[model samples]
Target: MMRSGLLLFFIGLAACSPPVTKSKAKIEEFRQYLEKSRTDDGVLLESRMLAGSNGLVWENSGKYQGDILLDDSQLEDLVADFAGVSNDNNRNAFVVANTRWPNNVMIFNYASNEFNNAQQNAIRTAMSWIEHFSCVRFRWRSNERVFVRMTGNPTGCYAHVGFSTAHPNRVLNLARNNHCFSHGVIIHELLHSLGFQHMHQTYERDSFVRINWNNIISGQEFAFTRFPRNQVNLHGLPYEYTSIMHYHNQAFSRNRQPTIVPLRSFSGTMGQMEQTSYWDWLRLRRHYNCPGAWNRNSEEIMKKEVERTLPLIKLNLPAPKQGLFTDEDNAYVRALNADTNNEDIVNEEAMDYEDSDNENNNFNEDIGNDNYEN
Candidate 1:
């Protein structure tokens, strides 16, 4: 009887399963999910409907990938900052940052024992960069169960690199023994954490070489950009790359070399006090808007600020249309749709498996299965 039931199940599956087809909406959604998933491993699953995209699988891999580490006090501090914005428009814009940070911010180096003074200083410097420019706050937590281990290089050193559960937030310069190490990398990664895609080399206007945006893998583009037309206002003012939230690398040239001068040349090392950019100040002010003089519990006020500001943040890319099937270009749309849907269902089940208890022990085994639907 058990054998007969199993044979019947197989027959049913064979009859129901269809072939793959082109789905433009699914493809575009897959692309967006791929872009957002790179920010952090945890939220990758939440970002898209793709069954087998690498970003989705990577997200389900149980690794913590965010930069902002928040403890109870820090969370309160951030909440208080949003409470201070007076203008309803500005306050609405501010709340977007608040909603994005807590769950989006993954914890790293939660225990003091995990880092030394220099490492702590590195973390502080990275945090300072985000705070001063990005208007985001960092905090520490006591929980280890939620923490994900960094793979690749392990010398038991925890200060290698840090990012958001979504993107690179703050990377520790464990590679640099001297204090003169570049904070630009941390800044660069932080921009990625914030959902900016790399600029195309052909479109760049500065002395810096533009990134080959086309070269970016389909899903990874969001790591370096705001949507093409999306204009994000850092504070009450307009946003600009000079605001310190921009990526700094070898500038545009026939031959690639560092085009922009190091920030340290104008200022000092991480310890040296530096003047904040206008945009930076505005970002902080917007982020921490409160009703009173201090505006400590301004979460509601900040929410209003974000709601207003979101419209201003425009994406350069065209709005994606739903139900646009890619694989069906000249082929039968019905057949293609059936195939894609079948693949999507299988991929979803696989993702569920990857997210379960067997993840760590079965990572290698699962990676092969993950590449199937992509």
Candidate 2:
């Protein structure tokens, strides 16, 4: 009777196991992109993609910062390919899939128990910060094949950016040896999973800060490269230095010297992760189109915050290029432009944030661009 019971359990397991969705092998252009991307370490490894800027550094699959499971291409490379392609079908070859999670809901599971009790709690609290400010929600899995798999490994913490319906499910690893358990560190990794990039390397960053090549570690210089403009849609935001996503002033330092210095003389901490900055919440709210953003009663309060934020450093983008926008893109731009100048709206309002009680407020059109100030 015991043997029969065991046999029944085995059959049930087989019946419920989800089948992997079949996808074709990598495209030839992707192959070439990888070939062009070779580093001294050889082909860019599968996992250690930098959190953003198309990830310039290469690490073994065991290590990484990129959020996409597959490697991301530099904007220049993608733009070049786009210009050369006359065949409409080939256009799909370079298409950047929609990386946002479905319905602003993130489903996840644990793949490893390497996290100490504190580390586990760190992960939970980080998720709370996201929920505290935006409409996004995090849920544990229950027979959900499409979900994030949090793992505690010896390798550095890294995550595949965004949701992948085509190949759902991925690992978000935190190394035990690394300070991956810190509240800010854990929050940084989670933001990548939610589709954010390093604050410093976003496009049009030159106007805000200066990158000191002489101070960066020799081989790791590529880590400081800036992303191209127009690739990342800011949704009408301006550059910000206080964002939790910004890099530390001494990051990747070979001699403990500053690698990034602000162009203007502003005094404040840089690359901090203790908690999300005020603008961080605004960007999160705007990016996901958080349903109810600010209470109308708070409009005057928001205006004050806007006045305080407007004079800060910012990188203003030119109007969208003609012929570049899709129909949907065109519509989004039209409505957004119809509202007001990106910086003006950000400075004028957008301070109101939703609480757990589900406060209803108008989307303030507050804005901020990703920025680095380490």
Candidate 3:
């Protein structure tokens, strides 16, 4: 009788298993849909330069603040803020409420040929670093409806600010052979995709550092634009000069002179991309509402918290009501251009990110053209 009961249990488990053929078909269907969604119909709303380790890198015509690809409504909100017409002072962490990745998880996919093995490893290393410090987790794409598609376009490194609602399938381009594969650069671009903006762009930045506009390159001034205080939630933490997201002293300089001068003397390096500073990691944890993120050994504590909440995941516990220093529940940020009718410009390719070994031989030929320009 016991043998018969065990047999029945095993049979029940097999019956409950999902059909393999149907799953493969569904995945293939999504791949076809993604291919059809690729287009070049987007407008060149804004562009900004970034000071990577290889010196000043120009922005692609369609990017904002160096590499952020903004969608329609986000662009509208930013335009209004830029025009000094916006009265909506929602102080969430300079991020759109809905832009946060659901469940603090990030789903990603990349073409096999877009990046070489070293670059791919760098991407994983950066993701691992974030995972080690915060509650944010990364997973290679399966059948996720919304995910970041990393490309190896030679257009300099850039990413959409977050999970774009207007373009659910977003692309983050890390230009091949463009010095974009460094661990720090990978972390910087990944942070952008994770919805974090440049630290110097925060509204209260003027009090800490002075922007030397005269030293800035012409037509690149947009890169140094600031976010208004009302539009940003700083989490009451003091300005972080050592933030990985902070630009180097000579960022966007036309004459190799300093553009960002500190008002007060400080220890440590400014705009160091070596690793995410403590404050930088803290903001990310808070943004994701990671439990016990404020205390030491928080990462281990968070891991246990995740385990404890597994059975109760459906309950969706509430986040902290307000920040320790601020009066808001989350920080809110806004930006981009005002064009609403334009489509996105990323041309995403679909394939198994890990197993596929196709080589993009045409990548060199494709780089010579100025297709990335407006």
TM-score (all chains, Cα) for each model: 0.32, 0.57, 0.61
Per-residue lDDT of model 3, residues 285-312, tens digit only: 7666655444444333334333432322
lDDT of 1 by residue, 1-374 (tens): 01100000000001111323436575455434433422333333223213332211111222222222232332332223223312335423422332233433444443334433443344455444344222344555455343333222111111212223332333321222221112433333333333322222112222332345444334433233222111222223333344343333432212333323332223332211122233333344343331121222222333332333222112111111111122223122232224232322212211111222221222222221211111
Q: How high a TM-score does candidate 2 get?
A: 0.57
Candidate 2 vs candidate 3: which has greater TM-score? Answer: 3
lDDT of each: 0.28, 0.47, 0.53
lDDT of 2 by residue, 278-304 (tens): 566556656566532333322232333
The CA lDDT at 306 in model 3 is 37
Model 1 weakest lDDT span, ten residues long: 4-13
Report each candidate's C-alpha RMSD, comma-separated, in the order given. 25.4, 16.9, 20.8
Please list the residue runs of candidate 3 whose C-alpha ends up more than 4 Å from where it truly belongs after superposition: 1-62, 80-96, 295-374
At residue 237, give the lDDT of candidate 2. Answer: 52
- Looking at model 1, residue 249 earns an lDDT score of 40
